[model samples]
Target: MEIINFGKGYPANVLLPHTLMQKACESHLQEEKKLFLHYGHKQGEEKFRELLASFLQQNYKTAIEKEDLLITCGASQGLDLICQHFTKPGDTIFIEEPSYFLVFKIFTDRGLNLVPINTGKNGLDLAELESKLKAHNPVFFYTIPTFQNPGGTTLQEEQRQKLVALSEKHDFLIVADEVYHLLDYSMRSPFPFCHYSKRVLSLGSFSKILAPGLRLGWIHCCSTLLNKMLEDSVLGSGGGFNRFISGQVYSFIKLGFQQQHLKLLIGSYRLRSGALYYFLTTILPDVICSPPEGGYFLWVELPKGINAQQLLERAKKHGVTFHPGYKFSTQKKLNNFIRLSFSFYDCDILEEGIRRLAKCF
Candidate 1:
């Protein structure tokens, strides 16, 4: 039997827009061959940045200046760039407890101190965050506010405003990883964090909505921050990262292909999410999980005395797989939790995976 895997947060291979991307590439070569083929600005091609700024402003209802955006390889690179420019080896960086597992390496590789704040159904605990902020004087607070990875929680607007206030009071930067914000299925998300605070550095990626191979993402911040980041030797040496790919993506957006693609992705994931949710809730009534309003994951908390790592080993025998929650925690305290992704499989495969998972429990 084929392994029904739910371990990685990735778009289904079938969902990738191969034809659309090909068309965009062809269009870029035909329309702007010279501009795309030649070395572009280290900050990004001016036209593409303008297009991106307009796209975000239109979609999120926030005014964005082209000068305030920096095109990075992807959100991962954006995070790395931020750490490189803004942090020292031993600086304190706060993050949500049970945060994105991969990013933990990014922080640790930089030799930065990782402080995790407890998260709940409503998102990060403000009291805990404020207390940590007051005591630590952290370099920055990193968050995946909307449809958070491994937690499936969206921070409320009120909490967002309050968090911004806290950032201002404590004078710490807010690094908002918002790649999942645009993938919402039903509930509307709040404006990007940059809108509420000038100190906020918002990171976005096309990996979820489009294809990950494109390797295109942007950093939204004040012009001051953008200028400082652009001064980094990496951008100066490379003359901007992913300029040609950025040009292709700009063509894709200019022709309105991204919006159409987003609708298809949202609709497909919504169905997959519902099917998995129903199966888990009905078959394993004792399992605690919330249906995510958007994004790719469902965070499940198993009953006490269950260790997710051991559970994964058993589930593997049944041809099912999922992400054990311990990987997502800085303190490694959530052994009873697991993260499930609905974006990697169709509804039929997802339901079967959950059915197999239920048996393991």
Candidate 2:
């Protein structure tokens, strides 16, 4: 079978630069080998923290400092630690109806009720959010403002401001899942939540843009909340990260090889996204699809009365696969929609896969 798997959000075909590895190895060898091999600070490497803080301050123009950041195993861990520290059984949390699945699982397993609001083209429906907030009074509002998962839509500038206003008025923290913040295809950069850092808790990861094997992620928030979350992380998982991977990542960053690699990665994804969109527009004319401003996935709505799950079975028969949209919804109402990732396939493969699905529909 000629398989075209667009089911996951991993870089489809990129290799770790041998130069980066050699540099890291050289650095590790220069140091006391035992220190490099041993455990690191639970908060993460200070040098890495400095690098992140400088970048965040420059990009987001926030008041964030080194003390405000907490490194984690991945952004997933940051989300988990937040839930662990702030929420309890029966607590109510708010989320956009079509959000990332793991987020829904986290809240559900913690016994927290989720209030999901419908999102509009520009992003979360602000008017609906105000209405829901007034009625349900949730503990926190979760959002993926930049290249949001499943929908692959971005929150407009006005909506970003409105969300911050809503958080303040409702007296709730805004949990911003921003692991894909840097993946915008547009010339202009998307707005990050750090502008409202005091009220907005942001999470980011190297897993999406960089390599996931590094297992490095970080959380940004006010010192009070961050300290609390850090204490919990220490108790639960202990502070130091995967020591070897940390050293590897540190060396890569120090050598400045990842920067050039990132540009290449983005350029490749941009081409892939354009190719995927072209295929859908030409091949799957009947499918309702949104052109993502930036991100890996294309969110498509099948014709009314057609079941996305059923289509997935047919697609699998054609040796193509993508995630069913219902998985992203807590209420499981988006059964007509599906998410197809373009980052994992070349232009030819993407076109072929779309052609296969087009035949089935």
Candidate 3:
């Protein structure tokens, strides 16, 4: 039997826009081969940044300028750059109780102290966050405000405004990792945090929307912070971040392929998500999951007394797989929860995966 994979947060291979990417490469090579191939400005390619700024302005409905944007390799590198420039060893950083697990290593490698703030279906608990802020002068609060990883929760707009207010009051930075913002299927999300506060540094990537292989993303922030990040030796010494990839991606975005591709991608995920949710709900009635409005993952709460790790092992034996929730936690809480990604498979595969997972239970 084929292993039914609901474990990895990757786009389905079938959905990758191979033709659009080839066209982008051909167009760039034909028009600006020498310029794109040559060394670019340390800050980024001016044309790419300008085009990206316009793209973001039109889609996100926020005022953005070329000076306020800096291209990075992707969201991972963007987080690393933030840590390298803005934090010190042992500095306090606040993160969602269960966030993107991969990011934990990034923080720990920097020797930063991570404090977990509890989150629910509505997103982070503002009261708990405010209490934590009162006690620690954290360098930044890292969050995936929309369709949060692991939890698959969206932070409400009131909470967002309040969080921004608290950030200003406490003089802390907000590192909003918004890689999944554009993938919403039902409702349009609120304006990004950058629009509300200068203290916010919003991260965006083509990885989720277009393809991760491109390795292109951008940081939106006030000019002051952008200037400081640009001065980092990592960027300055390297000349720029992914200049060639950025130029080609800019061509793709310029031709409006991204918007067209996004509709198809979102529709595919919507079907997969619906199928998975229905199957899990029917097969494991006690399991609790809030169907996500947008993004790749669905967060499930296991029945009482069930351990997700053991479930994972059993499911693996059954030729199925998913992420155990404890991996996403800083304090190793939430052992009864699991994160499942519907982004990597079709409806039939999702159904089979859930069936195998049900057998494990």
All candidates: TM-score: 0.98, 0.92, 0.97
Q: Model 1, range 1-361, lDDT digits (tens) per residue?
A: 9998898689999999999989988888899847577667988889999998888887778798898888989999999999999998999999999899999999999999999999977678999998876679898999999989989898889999999898888888999999998888875888888888899999999899898988889999998888889898977777888888888899999998988898899898888888889988998898999977899999999987889999999999999988898899999889899999999998888888888988887
Better of 1 and 2 by TM-score: 1
Overall lDDT per candidate, in order of appearance? 0.89, 0.78, 0.88
Off by over 4 Å in 2: 15-19, 31-39, 56-64, 233-237, 242-244
Error of 3 at 24 (Å): 1.2
In candidate 3, how many Å is residue 64 off? Answer: 2.1
Model 2 over residues 174-289: C-alpha lDDT tens digits? Answer: 99999877777775655578764488889988787677766788888878887777576464464465555666666666666666666676788888888898899888788887
Q: Report how far residue 4 has shifted in candidate 2, in Å.
A: 1.8
If ranked by lDDT, best first, what sequence of candidates would result? Answer: 1, 3, 2
Candidate 3 residue-wise lDDT, 211-246, digit = tens: 999888989899899988989886766789898888
Count of clashing residue pairs in every prediction: 0, 2, 0
What is the alpha-carbon lDDT of model 2 when measured against the actual structure?
Answer: 0.78
